[model samples]
Target: MILELKEVHGYYDKSHILNGVTLSVGQGTSVCLLGRNGVGKSTTMKTIMGMLNPKEHCKTEGSMKFDGKELAGMKSHSIARLGIAYVPQGRHIFPTLSTEENLKVAARAGVDGSCKWNLETVYTFFPRLEERKDSKGDKLSGGEKQMLAVARGLMQNPKMMLLDEITEGLAPIIVDQLASMVQNLVAEGVTILIAEQNVKFAMKVSSDCYILERGAIVHHQATKELTAETRKKYLGL
Candidate 1:
């Protein structure tokens, strides 16, 4: 497993939020954290990124391993430096910066002293971004902004990516574009973990699926093995 969480638990103040959440992701595949709102899907991503302290007040317990390295106690920046990139729920780009500048700012070598994504490479996959290269982030449309968010994450040359609710407000046409882009990234061997509330989209994009309810994993199966009936049963779609 490229990423693994074993018996993970977390707390917010005195309220227990995550209870024994465990899952795994293999290399070069997209995995979905499926659940209704208020479940621990988002928190799971945050915990793995080292943004949440499961160790605080000894209120959280679990093991988080990314590429065989223990991530439970590491700082967020440290984790990020390890070549794990996160694209959060909202498309938070530098609104004042031009699209090209935004991409340039995030350009850097991967941990192995190699970068697979640069202007030329990213542009090839997202020609629309190249067209808006000179436009400021705020001037772009919703689809363009989403593309830029994914592009910015690529600039880091990350080994693995954690994407949170990327299709939340995107239109169907734009979502189709993003889905194609995601499949292309997988073809290049980039591991991805996505948190999503949209079960239909998840069924289309993910190879492995885990259903989280009340902060715990209740179902896990290969997407191909999951029936449509099961999806409606869990996701209420």
Candidate 2:
């Protein structure tokens, strides 16, 4: 396994958000976390990223192992340095910096004998980014900002990526392009864990799916089994 969460529990100000949540990801595979609003989907991502300090009121009472190393109590920066790149929701780009600068900020030295991703490789995946390399992050459109966020994460040359709602409000055409790019990334052997409300879009790319409900997992199955009918019944489609 590349990552595993065993009976993980987390909270926010005495409010329990994750009730013994457990999941795992294998090497070079894509997994989608499906859920409606307020189901602790984003919280799970934050917990994995170490953004929500578990030691605080948000208690974490389980094990999070990545590549055979325990991850509990680790800081966000430390977790990031462990080769887990996160492309958060809303494409949190540095508005004042140019697109190229934003990507550069996330760049790190090569890891595990893999070559680091550079400007050329990012441009190959997102041609629009090349055209707007000099443009400020805030000046880019929604799709463009999203591209920059993904490119920034790629600059780290991470072994796995946690993508939270990468295709939320973009146009259908742009969404299609993003999906294609993700397919290409998977082909390059990058493991991905995507938390998405867009079930249709996720089903098109992920091989497996885990349905989350009220801070707990309700179902886990192959993506092909998540038909429209199943989504309508379980995911409130």
Candidate 3:
């Protein structure tokens, strides 16, 4: 396994958001965390990213291991340096910076003999980004901004990526493009953990899926086994 979470518990201030969440991800595989809104899916991503402070009431219990290294007490920057890249929920891009500049700003030196993902590579994955290389981040459409966000994370040359809501609030065509991009990334051996509300999209790209409800995992199964009836019942479809 490239990543493992053992009985992980996380809280935001007084509210306990994650209740003994456990999950794992293998190299070159994709897993989707599925749920309705406010089900601790995003919180799980934040916990894995080390954004929610372990100290000062935002408590985390259990263990998080990345490539055999314990990641419980690491800082957010340290976690990033350890080859974990996160594309946050809202495409948080620097509005004043150009698309190329945004990617450059997130680039870091390669680790573990991994090739550094440069502008050329990101452009290859998202040609729209290449077309808007000189355009300010604020000028791009919603889909373009989301693509840039994913590209920025890739520039860090991470072994695995945690994507939160990659296809939220986009047109059907744009969503299809994003889904194709994710499939390509998986084909190239990048481990992906995506938290999404779009069950159809998630099932299309992920081999494994976990459904979360009220900070707990309600169901987990292979994507092929997820039925429409199950989705309608558990996901309120």
Model 3, range 1-237, lDDT digits (tens) per residue? 999998888888989889988888888999999999999999999888887884666878789999899989888999989898999998899999999999999988656766658888888878888999999999999999999999999999989999999898999999998999899999988899999999889988999998898888889899779999889877998
Stretches of candidate 1 exceeding 4 Å from the true structure: 53-60
**What are the lDDT figures for the candidates, one per model?**
0.87, 0.89, 0.90
The candidate maximizing lDDT is: 3
Instruction: List residue ranges in candidate 3 displaced over 4 A.
Output: 54-56
How do the residues 1-237 of candidate 2 rate in per-residue lDDT, one tens digit apiece? 999998888789799889888999999999999999889889999889887774565666679998888988888888888899999988999999999999989988656756557888889888899999999999999999998998999999999999999998899999999898888899999999999998878888899999998898888999878877779877888
How well does each candidate superpose onto the true structure, as a TM-score?
A: 0.94, 0.96, 0.96
- 1 or 3, greater by TM-score: 3
Residue 173, model 3: Cα distance from true site in angstroms: 0.6
